[model samples]
Target: MYAQPQPQTTGRYIDLFPYIPWLLTGGMVFALIFGALWERTMVSTNLLVNPDTAAELKPIQLKKEPIGALRIDVNASISYNQWVTYEIQVKDQQGKVLASGIKQAWAESGTWVEEGESGTWAENDLMGGLDVRANQSEPVIIAIDVLEYSDTAGKEIDKPVSFQVIVKNGVVDDRYLWTGLFGTLLLSVLALFTVSSTGKVVINKSNPDSDVVARAICGNKDRLIRVVVKVQSDEYSPSSLHIRLTVNDANGEQLYSQTHLVNVKRSKSDGKVTSGSSALTTFFVLEPRGSYGFHAEVTPDASVDRTRIIVRENARTLFPVKVVTLKSSDAQ
Candidate 1:
């Protein structure tokens, strides 16, 4: 018999259906991440007041200067408990009402209603933002002016708002705060370095005498403040180092300078290289409304043990000497 025909072998191919679920899950994860980043959140970014209210309350009206009408744009929405009569009042310096009435304020739906997100305010779209500058340029008799607020029943809010306005006399921009923070960091780092390497340094208020002195004065038309520092060394000793201080107001166009010379003379002791003393005094000239801080740098003659002291009127903080030595190999 011819070779018996072997039974035809049959094989089944398994479908890749199981992997579809895994591929789908991976795609979903990536999609979610992309969607989160792509989503846009539009709101009144320069929100001066914290609208993240804790409870049944509106944003806190922070104390700030009224830049006439030029500084602000207003959008408002209101709901009223009931139709109630409200009054407007602007006060004088003597706390007397200069004007009071229901002054007509042009109101409309803000153009920024893009899905409850605060849209950008355009110059032309400045709604109902009555130019308070015309009446606001000079000190007013009206105790208050409703520049703009969320309304209650188509009427101005009569609710007693706990708000006050405080104006900054000079420019205190982001740079100022950043630099201040940086300076503070530098001081802290230096302080730590000194402690780790040498020992403790202290800051103390200086007693004014022949060796130590302090003086301060305001400068410029805008009352820009500057400092002048002077230190005169006497007795022709090696420890005597004269210090000159100069301060200039960086607040405005006009720069003013004030200076004071203080003497840093040798003490009445052995004129040893390491046996000497130093003192520092600071002067501050503050306007009726202004904020300021001191910036100080010190230079010593040769390699004397100089004191890094921060002195105020009644308090002083001292930083230690940080000697950074270099090894010959490291230098190479």
Candidate 2:
């Protein structure tokens, strides 16, 4: 029998109007991104002002990116050769003077400005300052510090503030560092969360019988050796007797291993055999340093599918752990 062919309808371009919403959505998203970046870059979130070249300081930068930033080498040029005074008004978000201090110093018209840990300014030319191209100094560093208020319920007041601008060159402009380390722990936890969320950590292929990611304490990186033994798959363990295992090191050098037996028994007037030491209980321990790895095959052994690894340290277990110096701890 002959089959008749069917007719096909040509499709028309009718979906353009439907995609207008998506186009508008995409444009809005693009504009929003640029606007957010512009706002973040232009508007300074810091409440501290650094008129002279100074590095504004804050506590530990929560994320890898810094949060507190002040104007250093600002775009507008200040008229030099005369006493051009600049004001560093310190206040909180509500415009209250949290604390105030100065990073006083003298420098070339437009040299690099550096602030010390206490916000003190100094010329980098003295402490390894640079001689930029065209034989011109980059900018002058500013010195600064925080002055706590002892009267206003233990608050620093800006009253009786200094009027003259004291300029001195060649002072170290170190960043005002808040190094008590409170939020670093929070940052670390966030970092771990990011890592786990991103799953960038790759677990190298190894035997399943040993602990792949074991927690170990090493005193130092120098003179330390570690060995891991892994038992392969256990698919054949149920019906079969014994299996073979091997271990190796970074250089594929074999260190310690032995063949084991398993599942040798009988019943109904038959003699059964049993070993007291199970291969699962077998582990290794080496001293000082060694080159390693091994395989274990066993017959009549308990769970040779399980492997043991020997880890060694620098004969010490003192690992450094940072803790917060809380006010409560201080009182105690």
Candidate 3:
């Protein structure tokens, strides 16, 4: 008579496949943070412009490798409800226009009353940014031209509008990084369902009789096996169900046995009570590469009109489960 070996209960076993997506997520986060820090280390300059006057900033030298970027930010001092627009251009040392754009700044405030609530709210927005990539290391000049100054009523203002411009180099573009992070997160969610399945169903029977019996052959030794029993009952069935699972070796000798309790709950849909089903699972390890017999029995057989039994081999879960050792007397 050959005795079966006990299941391994020592060190932990971690499956790294499920965690690969999280690892990729971490990498994208690191990249976004690193890009922000690198942007702060670049050179920045500020210039002032008055009405009807153009401001030309000093020549700026850019890095050749990795290519450099230029960012222009404009700020204006105006009266309430006033708006100002500026034309911005990036030119080479020879005065050739490399890039050009327009930006606007405005400020406004008003009162609102809705649903017996009255409050004063002030809102302002600025659409004043120009970003361009610098392909050459040669010095370039930034030029700013005041295009228009007016009030919210479309009336031209005679007063001069002072403007401040900020120019920065080596600014990293975060659009691609954000896109990559989003794509990686989506794929990670999808991988959880596709890559984490390690179990294969050996037997699946519906509406099985009490004391259901099945045989399964395992090609691998010391692999985990899972038994699942599901019961579907109407609202009139009992609240709880008891189940018994037994495993035996080729010689008809019992190896393990355990009892499970499944609770049944009733659900309401479209103003009608519906049947509810619950499942109970038991796990064990088969040590020898051979065929084994499984037996399952459910109590209150009349209450459980619908029953399903499943036997799975090489079963693995996303999380670890505790496997308890059973003595010879535990079998019934």
Stretches of candidate 1 exceeding 4 Å from the true structure? 1-239, 246-261, 265-271, 297-300, 307-332
What's the ranking of the predictions by lDDT, best on top? Answer: 3, 1, 2
In order, the Cα lDDT scores of the candidates are 0.31, 0.30, 0.69
| Clash totals for all candidate models | 24, 49, 0
TM-score per candidate, in order? 0.20, 0.18, 0.71
Model 2: residues with Cα > 4 Å off, grouped in runs: 1-183, 186-222, 230-293, 296-332
The residue ranges of model 3 lying beyond 4 angstroms of the native Cα positions read 1-6, 10-14, 41-47, 75-80, 160-164, 193-196, 205-219, 222-224, 229-243, 248-254, 260-282, 285-308, 317-332
Which candidate achieves the best TM-score against the true structure?
3
Clashes of 3: 0
lDDT by residue (127-192, candidate 3, tens digit) is 477877755567778787777888899898766556566766566677988998998898888767
Q: Give residue 86's error in model 2 in angstroms.
A: 30
The ten-residue window of minimal lDDT in model 3 covers 323-332
Better of 1 and 2 by TM-score: 1
Query: What local lDDT does model 2 show for residue 301?
Result: 43
